[model samples]
Target: MSALGTPRPSPLPAPPPGAPTVSAPEPQEPRSRKWIVWLVLILVGGLVVWQAAVKPRMEAQAERASAVSAIKAAKVFAGTLARTVRVSGPTSSQEYTSITAPIMRGPEAGRELTLLYLVDSGKIVKKGELIAQIDAKTLEDHIDDIGDDIERAEADVRKRRAEQAIETENLTQTIRVAQAELDKAILEEKASETRTVIDRELLKLAVEEAQARLNQTKADVAHKLQAHKSELRILEITKERHVRHRDRHKTDLVKFKMYSPMDGLAVVQMTWRGGEYGVIRQGDNVTPGMLFLKVVNPAKMQVEGQVNQSESSLFRIGQKARIRLDAFPELNLAGKVHSIGALAAGGWRQSYYIRNVPVRITFTEVHNKVIPDLSAAADVTITEEENVKQLALAAVRREEGKDVVYVRKGDQFERREVKLGLSNNTHAAVLSGLEVGEEVALEKPAIQMAALR
Candidate 1:
C-alpha cells in the first residue's frame, strides 16, 4: 500500500520463534477409499479377461481330451486285397478205413465192451495187423458155458434116443409073444370040430379072447413108439439151439481183436465221454458199432474241416487253398477243396449256435509230416483284387443307408461316403470315395463330437 498508492498482495502470517512450523493438510480424498476403488477396477478387468479368453480355452481343452480318448484311427493302404476264407480242422485222408467195435452177442450183448489193449496211434500198420483188442474174457466164458450146455444137451438127446430104442424093442418082443398066442388060439379053434359041443364052445371063447389080447398089445406098442419119437425130437432141438449159441459166441470172440484191413497209418478215434470228445484208450469202454480206430493212407492225404455258414458259399469243389499245420509250422501244403457238405452242422443244443459246413480239402502232394489228425488251418482265397485301396473294417461305418468313413483332416475328421468292393472280416476294399495313405477313424467320431457339443 506504500509504493504507488495501490494495495499490496497479502502475505502468510509469520511463525512463532523457535517453534516447529506445520501446514494444514490440503483437501484430498481418503487413501483407504482410493485403494478400494482401484481394487474393484482390477477385479472387473480380470473377470472380463476370463470370460473372453481363459474359460473358452479351458472348455476347448476338455473337449479335445475327450475326443482323443474316444476315437481310434487307422491309415488306409494300397495292397493286393484278397478275400480269403480261413478255417481250422484236423488233417485226414481222403480214403480211410474205420475200425469199429465188434458186434457182441449172447450174454455180452447190449453192453459196452471194455478196451483191453490199444495200439499206439500214428503207427504204420500192414494189412491184418492188430489195431485194437477188446475185452473177450466175458465172451470166452460165455462160449465155454454154451459149449458145456451143448455137450449136456447132446448127451441128454443120446440118452433119450437110447431109451426110446430100448422101449421099442421091449414092446416089439411083447407084441411077438401076443402074436404067437393068437396063432395057437386060431389052431385050437380050427381043431375044435373033433371035440364035444360044450368043449368046442369053450375053445372058441378062448380063441376069441387070445385074438383080442393080440390086437390090444399091438396098439399099445405103436402108441409107445410114437411117444418115444416125440420125446427124442424135443431133445434134439434143445441140443441144436445150444450148439448154435456156442457158435455165435465163438464168432463174437474172434471179432474182439480188431485188425486193419489195409496198409496205412492208424489213428485213434475220438470217443464221446462226459459231453466232450477224447481219444479212445485202454480201459475205456466202447459200445458196439462205435468207431475205435481209423486206418488212413498217408500217400493220399486230405483235410477234414468245417467252415462257418457265412464262408461256406465261397468254397467250391476246386478252390485252391494253402494249409499250415499247427504242429509243423514250417510245412506249408497246397490243396484244393474236394467236397462241400450240403448241410449245416452244430445247431441247437450245441455250446454255441455257430453253424458250420463240412469241407474236405485234398492235398496236391502228400508229405510224411502231413499225417492224419494233425490240426491244420486253411486259407482259401475266394477272390483277389490288385493294387486296391483297403481300409480296416472297423473304419467303415453305415450312415444314412450308405457306407461311410471319417477321413482325418488337420486334426479333425471329415465324413466321406465310400463304395465298397470286396470285403472280409478284417478289411474292406474301397472302390471309390477314399484314397490310399489317408487316415480314417476306426470308430465312430460322431459320438465324441456330440459329447463335446
Candidate 2:
C-alpha cells in the first residue's frame, strides 16, 4: 500500500494470462542506512571548510580594524630641543639706591627721628630733588642758639684782647717812669762828689733805693703781661670751641633735608612701628640707620626669581631667557641669567621642605611697562642641543620598571627599551634605542576579544 493511505490498484489484470506472479522483494535496511551515512558526510565536510578558511579570514579583518582605530602614531625627529626651567617672582631694578635715616652717633645714638615730610611713593624723582624732610625744627632751633653763642664768644674774645692791650701799655708806662727815677738818682749821686762825707753817704743810699724800685717795676710788668696773655689764650680757645659746635650743627641741619641721589622711582620701605609692620610715611618715627625708602632705576630692570633645588643645577649664568610680566602679559621681553645664588635658600614664603636658589635675570631690551616689584615669570633655556633625536613625551611609556616605547614595523608594533636624557614638558631627548624618522605608537593598541577566542 502507498504510504499516503490510498488504496492500491487492482493486480494489473492478474499479470497477463501466463505471466508468473512474482512477489516484490522486502525493503532492505542496509540500503536505507547507507543513504543516511552519505547525508552526514556532506554536512561534516562543509563545516571543516568554513573553519579552515572563512572564519580565519573574518577574524583577521576585525583585528586590522581595531588596530587602525585604537593606535596613534608619531614620527621621531632630529632637531633642537630646549630644556628649560620656569620660575616666577617679582620684577626689580638691577640698580637701586637706598635712603636711610640720618645716624647721629655719640650721645644721640639710637635716637628715634621723626619724618616731617615724605614724597609720595611711586613718584618719579629727578637727581637732586628733595625726597624727604626729617623733623628739623629742633635742629634749627639748636643751630640758632649755637649761632648766638658763637656771636657772644666772639665779642668776649675781642673784649679780652682790648683789656690785655691796655694793661700792657700801662705796665710799660710805669716801667719807663721807674727807669727815669733811677737815672736821675744816679746823676745826682755823681754830682755830690764835692760834698762832705755825710752828704755822699745820703746820695749813695738814694741811688741804691731808686735802682731797687726800677728792678721791681720791671718784674711786675713781666708778671702782669704774662697773666694777660694767658687770659687771651683762654678766650681764644673758648671762641674756637663755639665755632666748631656751630659748624657741626650746620652740617646736621643739612642732613634733615633729604635729596634724591639719582633719578628713579621712589619706593617707601616697610618699617616695624607701634608694634606692627607698615610702610614708612609722613609723621612716622624711624630709627637711626633704618632704611626709609628706595630709589630704583626703572630703565635697568631684572626679574628676581627662585629655582627649585631639583632644577637649580640646570641654571647657569648667561643663559638666555624669556620674561613675561603677569600684570602686563602682552609685553614679552628677552633676558639672560645675570646671576645665581651661591647656595640654596628657603623657598618662597618659607617653604622649608622645598628649597630654592635665587636667580636674577636681566632684561636685554628696556620697556616702558617694566617696573620694580611687578610680578613676572621667567623661562630659562638651560640646555639646548641641536641635531639630536627626540620624541614626544606621550610616546614614552614605562613598563616592567624600564622606559619603553612601541615602535612600528610594517603592520605590527614591537615593544623596545629606550635610554632617555634631558627632557622638558613636551619632548624628551632620546639617548639610544630610537632612530630619527621612525614611527612610534603614542598609546597601546587595542586587542580584539573575538580574535582571541
Candidate 3:
C-alpha cells in the first residue's frame, strides 16, 4: 500500500544482504523494562552453559582444595609433668622419765617401802605417780619395836645418870669433909697460940695431927673424881648415839614412798618379770635404788611419712607440702620441708626403716588431729601453666598423621591445617594454625559422624 500510496512505490530502500538488524530501543516505563532485561540475560546464560560445562569444573576445583587441606598435624615437645610421692609411717616419743621408791618390812621383806599401791608394767599413772604405798600395820609394828628399843636405851641412860649423880654427891661430901678438917686444923693451930716455947712441942704435935687428917681427906676426894673420867665420857657418848639412831630411822621411813618427778603420765617401771611391761602393786617390795614407775609427757605430737628413693628425689628441702588426715580430710594443712633423708632404705619397697635419716617436714600450723602416733601421705607438684588454646575433643578430625579443622568461609566449609599440642579424653590443646573468635564447624560431616559414634 505504501508503494502505490499509491503513488510511486517511492523507491523503497533496497534490502541489505545477510545483515543482522538491531531494533531501536523504545522509551519504556521502569516496571516494563525490568522483566525484559531479566529474560534476555537468562537466554544468554543458557547458551553459554550449553556450550561449556561450568558447574563441573567449579566442583572439581573445590574438591581438590578440600583434599589438600585435610592433612593431620603432630608435634614433638619437651613435656614437664607434675609428679606425686606417696609415703606411710608411724610416730614415736622424744623423752621419758622414771620414779622409784623403797618398800619395807613384813611378808614383803625388810626392803624399803615400795609396795602397797598400784604399780606395774604397761600401766599408766598420773603426775604424782604413787605406784605403791607403805603398809600402815607394818609401819605401826616397826614403830612399836623402835619404841621398845628406845625405852630400853632410856633406862640404860638413866642408870648412868644416876651413877653420875651419886659420884657428884660423894665428891661434894668429900669436899665438905676436907673443909671441916682444914677448919679444925686451923682452930687447933690458933688455940696453940697460948702455949709458950716450953709447952709448944705438945700444941705443935696436936696441930700437926689435924693437918695430916685434912690432907688425907683432900687426897681421897681428888682420887675419886679423877678415876672415873673415861667411864663418864663413854656413858655420854652412848646416850647421844642412841638418840641419833632413833631420829635417823624415822627419817628413812618417810622416804619409803616415791612419786612422779615430772608432770606427766606414769608407767610401771617393773614388769611381772622384768621390763617396763608389768603391774606394780601396794604389797610389792623394793630396794632403796629400785625403779618404781615411769613418767611420759603428752602434748608433743607429730605426723610421719615414708618415701622411696625414686620418690625422694622430687621431694626437696623448702618445697611446699600438704596434708589431709583421714580423720579430718576437710581440714587442709600446709607445711614446709624441714629436712630430707640422709641414708638409703634397708628394705625392699621400703618395707623396713633405718630411722637414722628419715625425711622430715615441719608443719606450718599445729593441728590437734595429729596425735603422737599418726600416719599420713603427701603430694608435690612441680609444673606450672598459663594461658593456652583449648577445645572440645569431639570437633577435631585427623587424616594420616595430620590434624585438620573445618572453618566456615562464605556459604561452604573449607578444610584448614592445624598444629595440635596435647590432648586428654575430653579436651585438646591447639598450638597454632587457628585463632580465637573465628567461626569453625562443630557439626560433623555425615560420613565422619557415622563412624565416630
Candidate 4:
C-alpha cells in the first residue's frame, strides 16, 4: 500500500578545498578473511589446551607420585557415629598394701638380738604379749659378782676386827705390867723408901711399852673403818651399772617380739615390687619398726587411675564408671564416681609427669571380691546421649572447630561441616548437617582405596 506519498532522501553540502575527508574502509576479499579468522581461532584453541588439558593432567600425575601415606595419622576425625566413649584403665586397690609391723629397716641398719628366742615368723602375738626374750644373763652374772664382793667385804671387816681384838689384848697386857711395877715401887718407896729410884730404868721402859701398844691399836681400827666404807661405795656403783644393763636387756627383748598393731587381716610385707600372697620368711634380718606384715580393715576400699590430661574433657566427678579386673574382666563390675583431682598428681620432673594432674575415678559401689587396691581396668563413661541418629564412626573427622565429612552428590565431592552428638568406636550419633539414607565417605584408613579402585 502506497497510500501516502513516500519521503524523499535529502542531499548534504560538499567539503571545502584542502580539508581532509573521513571515509569507511572498503570490504576485504572473502577467501583472505576466512584464512585469517581460522588462524586466530587455532591460536586461541592452543592456549585453552595448555590450560585445561595439559596442566591439570600434569598436576594429577605429580600428586599421585608425591602423596605420602595413609593414617597412622595422629589426626583422626570424630564422627557423630559413636554410642559412647570407651576407655581402658587399670584397676587399683583402695586398701591394698604392703604392711609390716616394723617399717623402720634398711641396708646397714638392723636390730641386735642378744638371744631373740620366740620372735620367729608366723607367731600370733597379742597386744603386750611377750614375743621374745633378750639375754638378761649378764645382769645375773653381775649380781653374782656383787654377792662375792659383799662376801669379800664382810670377810675383810671380820679380819680387821680380829686384828683389832688381838692388838687390844696386847695393849691390856702391857698396861697390866706397868701397873704392877708401879705398885711394887709404891710399896717399897714410901717417903724415905723413895730411895727405890735405883729401879727407875725398869719403870720407864714399862711405861713406854704401854703407850706404844695403845697407839698401834688405835691406828689399826681407823685404817679398817676407812677400807670398809670405801669398798661399800664400789658395791653401790656396781649395783647401778648392773641395773641399767638389765633394764636395757628387757627393752631389747620386748622389741624382738612382733605383734599385730591393728586387728583385721594380716598379710606379710612384700620383699620386692609385684611380689604377692604374703610370703615373708623368718631369719630375714628384720629390724625394729620394720613392717614384716600388715592387718587391714577390708570394709573400706578404693580404686585409682591416672588419665592423660588431653582426654580430661571425657571425665567428671560423679560420672558412672565401669571396671574390669585384669584378673577378672568377666565380672564386669559396676561403679560410680566419687571424686576427681583438682590438681595434677606429678611434677614436671615426676615420673608420671606431675605436670599434668591425674584425674582419680573411684568406684562408688563395688563387689566384695573387688577388694580395694585390687588392680583392674577402668572405663570412665563421661557422657551419654541416647535416641540419636547414628552412622558408621569412620565417616567423621574433627575439623578446626567442628566435625566434618566429604559429602558425595552424583559424581562430584564437596565438603560438609557436621554437628556431632555421641560416639563410640563402632558408631557416632549424627546431630545435624546430615540426613538419613545419604551416603557419606567413610574417610577411613581404607578410604583411599575407593578412589584407586
Model 4 stretches astray by more than 4 angstroms: 1-109, 112-234, 251-257, 261-263, 272-279, 307-319, 336-354, 358-360, 368-374, 381-392, 398-417, 422-429, 433-453
- Candidate 3 lDDT at 170 equals 83
- TM-score for each prediction? 0.63, 0.66, 0.42, 0.45
RMSD, candidate 1, Å:
13.2
Candidate 1 lDDT, 40-98, residue by residue in tens: 89999999999999999998988776676567789999998887888788887878898
Report how far residue 123 has shifted in candidate 2, in Å.
2.0
**What is candidate 4's lDDT per residue for 295-320, written digit by digit as tens?**
44444444566665676666767777
The reply for model 1, stretches above 4 Å from the true place, is 1-80, 88-90, 108-114, 135-151, 194-208, 270-278, 283-288, 299-313, 325-331, 350-357, 369-376, 385-453
Instruction: Please tell me which predicted candidate would have the highest TM-score against the true structure.
Output: 2
Worst 10 residues of 2 by lDDT: 444-453
The runs of at least 3 residues in candidate 3 whose Cα sits more than 4 Å from the true structure, single-residue gaps closed, are 1-97, 102-114, 119-131, 134-140, 191-237, 259-263, 270-284, 301-453
Worst 10 residues of 1 by lDDT: 1-10
Model 2: per-residue Cα lDDT over 96-200, one tens digit each: 999998876324446688999999888999999999989978777877887898788889889888888888899899989998998998998998969898999
Count the clashes in each prediction. Answer: 0, 0, 29, 42
Cα deviation of 123, candidate 1, in Å: 1.4
lDDT of 2: 0.84
